[model samples]
Target: MKPNVLLIMVDQMRADCLSILDHPVVDTPNLDQLARDGVLFENAYSATPSCVPARASVLTGMSQASTGRVGYQDKVPWNYEHTLAGEFTNADYHTQAIGKMHVYPTRNLTGFHNVVLHDGYMHYSRFKHNTKTIESQEYTDDYLNWLRGKTGQADLIDLGLDCNSSTVTRPWHLAEELHPTNWVTTESIDFLRRRDPTKPFFLNMSYVRPHPPFDPPQVFYDMYKDLELPDPSFGGWAETEDTSGEGMSPVTAKGLVPKMRLKRAQAAYYALITHIDHQIGRFLNAMQEFGVYHNTVILFASDHGELLGDHNLFRKSLPYEGSAKVPFILADPGNNLGLKENSRVDKAVEMRDIMPTLLDAADIGIPDTVDGKSVMPLCKDGEDMPWREYIHGEHAFGEKSFHYITDGKEKYIWFSQNGEEQFFDLENDPQEMTNLLKVVDYQERIEKRRNQLVKELEGREEGYSDGKSLIAGRTPKPTLRFVFE
Candidate 1:
């Protein structure tokens, strides 16, 4: 029988947060257990590190350029023909998504048979900005509506939290049962109870915690609040960052804040992760109770990594490791398919590979248009497959707009706005604190990677590449959709 596929996604979770990854503070026991049971991709990344574009790549098995979402723009129409859920649905799987789809129209479904969405306080979908008014937050989001019903409050103001701001750390205003993380897990467990059992199922439990407000349940908050947490990392090249602005949230600005303030935020962030980890444990129990634990293929990943004050950067969208790399683990049912147990694959991989990997595992044909190659063969101990030498990634963020390439061993970055270049040897400088672009000994490899990036963006209008060398000082659009000439 084809395995029931459970694709679990978390938002803005760092790749290094797992105990299995030797994270000193945070503990994700559930995820660690999953890693021990399956293959973990040590170098998984998000090509575009914001929510929408990264999700677009995950859904369509396409590159950011191919998905036409090269930046973090809301309300762009999602018109992809062969989404991951759509393909599974076509193959007769019962497809359902619970929690944060983050797709446009808020209820697009994107080929899922049904979606219970909670996109988490999007400013664009709020009342005043919503022209139709019918698609406003209260009416559009199933979670918010449920939250309102649970609280018995007509209107709630983000539960005293900011979606984009990482400055504040607080306990959840509502009960833990009503929290969005628990809601997503509860809904998914209920899905197992209600799904058509004869046919295999495809369920996406997309959690939206650990992304913002740095809010978790108070118990979780207390769990890490008193620990001797390490201070935020500061890169040597980050001395000139702006650290003095009133409205500067973590995502919008780069700078160091008070040590206590940063530590509190990190505590809450880890607390949120542990909260979700516990909820995942609950989810697994429900799966076992429903008699589906032994016949499911469980895959877990995050949309992107939070900067968490790394290099004086807070939110994602930068090309730094803290913003781009994410945890990706696939746990097969007791290595039933000859997959390696408790093994790690260090080859470069990204969100695009998810669609093909899941489809291949279910014995389905991957669409020919997908740019991602399946990594399933790599999971089998002796199976050999052609693999990518490096994965290309980029995003548009005004002056921060950048492009780069990395093969897990080295990375090359080019700022499209100012033509500034940065190179890092991951083997030596995993922290990416020291820039190696000016080192004469590394110039040859630097130019090689630069040429590779040029080849990737050669024909673009941004004048990024001029065949022989890369150019700079070109203004970048916030959103770059594919255009047909």
Candidate 2:
């Protein structure tokens, strides 16, 4: 029998936040069970932390900059030809996507042949609002008009935070009962129940909550309300002595995150992650009840990590481990046959490896255009292809941006547009408390990684630099500069 694929994606999830990862504060019994029953990577990093770029990387198996997508709120270029969606479709697999595709303008590939998307929840395109009476149409309207009946607020949504965050609110969380993962899972199970059954299917169950606004149900929030969140592990968000170019309020003095609210925010963030786990558990259980668990290959991961006060940052893309790393788990029950269960792999992996791995798992020929190497062997056994020597990720904002190449022990980052370089030794300073680019002892290592980074990105359009710019890459192409502006 052909294998089925279930790709479960959550937004803003961290690599170390899992119970299997031994995170003390967050509760993830289901995920822990998954880790025990499958293959979990202790170190996995995203190509980019922002929504669109990371999603694009996962879908296309290429760097975001190479895709020419540098910011959120951008669309796939008209010329991106090798997306995994098309490949799966070509493989004769019935492809479908539910929840936050996060791709832009709805016309976005839908990737799958079938799609039921959350227009408002993920990339709700309504223009920002002011006074008058405030407005929201995407999420709630989709829920009321198309999704739920007029009275469809029946279940899901209704987290402790104001329901105003939902589809109807200015920013819109919808109702706590309409919580994203729960809604996403519900749609996925419904699809599975109604599937044709004559063919294998590939489904993308994506969630955008637990990304921000940290809104969880009253009960979930209660679970972590009193738990004291660890303080910022890396001193704080310090700025260069000259703050003229980037002068902003220190993290502690932000809009609503003053002293009194930080505690609640932290708790809410943890609760939201637990909320994602709960819904994922429900979905996994449903697969078992339907008896498809053993036949399906389940891949669970997140677009990127969030900063619940880590390094005084909020969302993603800072080169900090907190926002750069994500959780990854792959389970193929029957194929495991006699393979060990409840095991883990400690090798370093990059999110870019996902596309190749998934297609390889499905027995689809990975197109030569894909820049990632398959890590499937690592799953079958811890030893694979000597593991990767280094992985690359980038975040580009206009002409200026940052790129990183890490050997797992040390990381070298270059802020290209500004010509600034940074080096951090994770093996020694886990929190990345200090920049060692100029440290006499680490200078050689820094130069080596820097050269490696340039070499890796060489002959690649977006990766071009003084040494490699003249060589042909993807294209000199137009910039989606409007999004960054």
Candidate 3:
């Protein structure tokens, strides 16, 4: 059963930010509808909670610890082995990657034959001389260049201020009509119009809006202003005393002052998500337009979630649900596995399972070597997966390092260097407002999980899920039943 694959990944987006998640301040009707007609995973988790590494884990079907890509600035070292796209290609599927993969070089395209990256005009922050794309001028070329060419916009190139050192004086709408979604959507649609259908394609596309700069053009930016943004996780601020890393604060903790205007930042973030949701509408429409709607599988998700001031953090890299819980939507047009729309799965799912799941969905063999289990059963109801009781993740950004494991009821976090420990009984405190690392009684549970973590890490290595046994191929093919209504 040959079918097409369209995987949509958004950067730094939170699972709870959507209206479907009962987030009152934002409107993402497009995503809302998509979730309705798709299986929503309520507890999908990141393999590791950083951008580059998290994305790499999803693509490679391995843990970030094994890939050695613990840094945001680190390249997805080719040594990790075959990526999902590469696997599909090897299996004779035509693969493409458009939008933001956030792979190093920003637009490396990695293995996908067709690559289009619409960046946030991300420059080489750590490296000065490298051009992100093969085409040097393209980074700031399209609409950004056109906007810069405009009279009023031209004078405000840098806003004559340092974005890192900016203050929250007023609600500032990021200036520009050419938002990342606009450009990304245009490129995606163009790719769709020219796509060849006979080959059965696999497009690993991504959207770069909700990632950073918390900037959106006018209409979108205004869409959420004064929308009664949710109260700031309630001094989600002071709770960071237990976390490790830099100041990681937005207040006057340093000479930088406060970087985000809480209200304004929320408004901008909501707007960016809305804009992204609209683009999703466009892609969904494209599926129907191309007559591939019933023969393709659509996956929409984020690599990891952003904190957005939860615990006073801006991005992912923390273990709180705000940072680790990512969107997991699997919409099978054929409902091959009998997955129903708007159905929510309560089981704990790690991102590592995505590779094997996709392989299984496509009738390929599941690799036993991969540490993640396939969830196609729970997705369609074959066998119970025994849902993971504890999900583990780590953050190795720069010199900062931390490890965490959570089982929905309890969470344990530890920093290696100074050996700081933090624990929370999430069932009692979902907000994780309290720390119990050094608490008694919980010691046994913490030690058990720590031992489990060590065993899991020690088993890590290179290769596909079931590489050797793939001599016979393991991705399972399910009995399918398609329904139009």
Candidate 4:
């Protein structure tokens, strides 16, 4: 009787925009029917791609140099011990967390039993930058105090837009039920109709609009306004060009925006990813109208990935697989675990294996200061497990601080601050557009992933690896510049 977990998350989403990851135009028919009912890790990742250190390595399953958060700092002090909804709210499960919780005293219930926040538009929770004000939206955010009690309004500045802009692309001006992705799916279908039906629930809807004021609601921006979309992934070790008009700024992260404003900002970022995939198909038909949809397990992920402009980059810290890959899926709904429906695990996983694979699929236990492991024997069938051939990833965002390591079929990176070194072969250029690190037939596979990134950055201190090499120009720090005793 343990199942029910749900966890949806999504902010700056990308992992090739799922249409089962073919994503040529982003339709996501209910996340491709939750990837045909389960298990599609196709090399997931988010080893610190952004959003507060990829949600602090997804609520502490660890890694990101053991949760000290290797970059993108904000307030710090999540003081973790164990989490993933505090170990399924310590096995009794009834946790909550609706919409975004970018952590830190914006009411830190890092172990949610309730978290109806709406961390959208956070410029460090601006109410004049912190200590919140503007009189009141109930002191800052419960989706802007329920959109000022359904728009009798007071603020949320009538969508002039700037929730971390990508410069511009519009549509949603108002009423899509005051869109914060439909107020996080109507507060997660009103917490599955006022939850607590004898425990067994974990919730956490999370979503902060494809991540940006990419706005999506003029009927999902005219349903991809005159389709044709596709052109961005360019890379011969990308530098970018063609800034046609030279006025870009909806939050410009690099350059070349102006192929009709980068196809109307990629058609308003695929109309805010099909309006958050039809508001996650109305929060999965309200979890099958409260029966918790066939026992439940679901999971879908995304704390990172959204280079929307690819190598010309734009948003996300960028080691670039469209900004550090992401889009795991899990789904169980009582297939009785052993995953399999629409299978595809291709190894490499990350974001610290999502809290020991949802606390080892609810029997719950995984804690030895978790460093992530439980992929439930790679979702069953033959079950050999023993994975992790590679996963390391990094961020720091200064001169776009870097570091990487892959194993989802080759990738090495580096770039601390111009010590540059790239080498991709993501199974024959998965749009990483070739840079076999000076290709002398891939110098012994770039000296074995640069000696596994010098044994994963040996004893860093801006030294950036010396167990055998890679010392780049250094000086990058937003955090994790070194403090581990």
lDDT of model 1, residue 326:
95
Per-residue alpha-carbon lDDT of candidate 4 for residues 359-391, written as tens digits (9 for 90 to 100): 888888888998888776787752366687888
TM-score of 4: 0.35
Off by over 4 Å in 2: 76-79, 119-124, 128-176, 240-257, 335-340, 398-400, 457-464, 468-485
Query: By lDDT, highest first, what's the ranking?
Result: 1, 4, 2, 3
**RMSD (Å) per prediction:** 1.8, 5.5, 9.2, 20.3
How accurate locally, in lDDT, is each candidate? 0.86, 0.67, 0.64, 0.79
Segments in model 1 whose C-alpha atoms lie over 4 Å from true places: 127-130, 154-158, 240-243, 246-252, 382-385, 481-485
What C-alpha lDDT does candidate 2 achieve relative to the native structure? 0.67
**Steric overlap count per candidate:** 0, 20, 9, 6
Residue 311, candidate 1: how far off, in angstroms?
A: 1.4
Error of 4 at 57 (Å): 18
Error of 1 at 275 (Å): 0.8
| Clashing residue pairs found in predicted model 3 | 364-475, 365-474, 365-475, 366-474, 366-475, 367-465, 367-466, 368-466, 369-465
Q: Write the per-residue lDDT of candidate 1 for residues 1-485, one digit (tens) a residue.
A: 68899999999999988989998999999999898889999999999999998999999999987887778888777888799999999999999999998987788989999999898878777747544676688678898888778777734355565787675677887778988899999899889889997999999999998899677999999999999987666667875546366325544446756667788888999999999999999998898899888788999999999888787678899999989999999998546767898999988899999999999999999998798878888888422666888989999999889998999889999888888889999988888988999999999999889989989888776677787777887767545645222
Worst 10 residues of 3 by lDDT: 476-485
Question: Which is superior by TM-score, 1 or 3?
Answer: 1
Tens-digit per-residue lDDT, 1-485, candidate 3: 47787788888788888788888777788777767766778778885776667777777777655455543544323544567787788777878776666565555655677676554444443233774445454453344454455534542224332222112222224434355566666666667778766688888767776766555667777787757777546332244342343443332121211334666767777787888888788777877887877877777888888666665555566667777888888878666556766777867777787887787777776554466666777777623556667777776543335667776567776554345667777777777777765678778987776665555444233211232211111121110011001
Q: What TM-score does structure 3 among the candidates reach? A: 0.80
C-alpha RMSD between model 1 and the true structure: 1.8
